[model samples]
Target: MKLNFLTLTPKATVIGLIMGLLIVFLGRGLGLFFFFMMLWFLVLSAIVSFIGKKYKLKRKLFEDTRGIKNVIANGLWPFLLVLAYYFLSSNQFLKYALIFAFIGSVAAITADKFGSEIGVLDGEPIMLLTLKRVKKGTSGAVTWLGISAGILAAFLQSLVMLPWIGYFGSAGISMLWLFVAAILGGLAGTLFDSILGYFEENGKGNKYTSNFFASVFGSIIALTIFLLLF
Candidate 1:
């Protein structure tokens, strides 16, 4: 039987394996970690694959697969926050904050990714600041359809963390808060990304730097909301 591993580059496969092991070692155990990892991987793959086919583009989706830098810039903070959650597992308060932060970070990045991939396809993008129509794929450009898709994507990504609610012993009352934090965080992150993109386009910074800052900003926003509400 052909294996799905064949489709991944050697480096990507290695990184996935390492991340799996790290998650298992971080107190999630093999079984639970594997389940979470599989679900996360599959969902992201489906999104990327759909966009790739729709755009008939091979390079954009696969760019991160070949290098460690993009993965670190876009994803490392969330993973570190996951590790922080485990480290603070003994402290219910801090653990809860970290958990929300982690989920928010992931949701933000997912929303941003969805916005970028799907948004570009919508014709006649408008600059977020000036409301002027810009070239398609122009930095800081947005559309109504794209923003709608991003909000929906954020909601879906938050739902993915539902299985952890029970595991973390979060009260049912807090469910709405989690979803709100995630959606808001996602929107905040995407806005940060667009702002940074505007600067990047004006020759202020590079894509990687903007993404890193956006992810960090999202995490902070999530943590802030959790602290305020609970």
Candidate 2:
């Protein structure tokens, strides 16, 4: 199904502003960095959401606006990590890990959004697990277009967030290690989302939960890798 999103409803806007405030306030030293990165993610995701907009509208698969749930789903994990950073940042190791974890969540959401929105424009899709042909907007579906877009978004997200993350700092993590944690976490998280979509198609889950779990999963992946290397 084609769902359109870009505009945030008034309530969503209010909640989003609250979340932004939390990021800015809770981040303390990293406040500006989180604020700027969050804004950057918003603009990037919004642009991707606009792809095939005219076409999607005509096709009746677009919903035209996003609600508070959408905002919460997309922003919750990142926001929680920011909150965690406020409390746990005294530990140098956890601080850097939290930064990479934050990157993973943002990257995953951005990647998934890019994959779905851009993929819908490409052509028909096939289910990720079954490889059976499916509609272009079919949940759990895969398209080369979507895959490429997801990878690109993940890479770009990780690349841009590095400055905010401060290139591993005194935590002793290598830049390459951070990149591996982030980019791979994003890709894995997108795949996890599509797999969850399989359950969604069968009515076992919903989009909000899927998005939330996907972010958490991405964060875990990055954190796990970082810990492993540490």
True-vs-predicted CA distance for residue 193, candidate 2, Å: 0.7
Q: Using Cα atoms with residue i matched to residue i, what is each candidate's TM-score against the true structure?
A: 0.81, 0.90
- Cα RMSD of all models vs. native, in order, equals 3.8, 3.4
Per-model lDDT = 0.67, 0.81
Model 1, residue 170: C-alpha shift (Å): 5.3
Q: Write candidate 2's Cα lDDT for 36-65 as tens digits.
A: 666666777778877788998887666557
- Global fold similarity of model 1 (TM-score): 0.81
Tens-digit lDDT track for model 1 on 155-217?
Answer: 877776576667544353367787888888878887788888887779988777776777777
Lowest summed lDDT across 10 adjacent residues in model 1 is found at 58-67
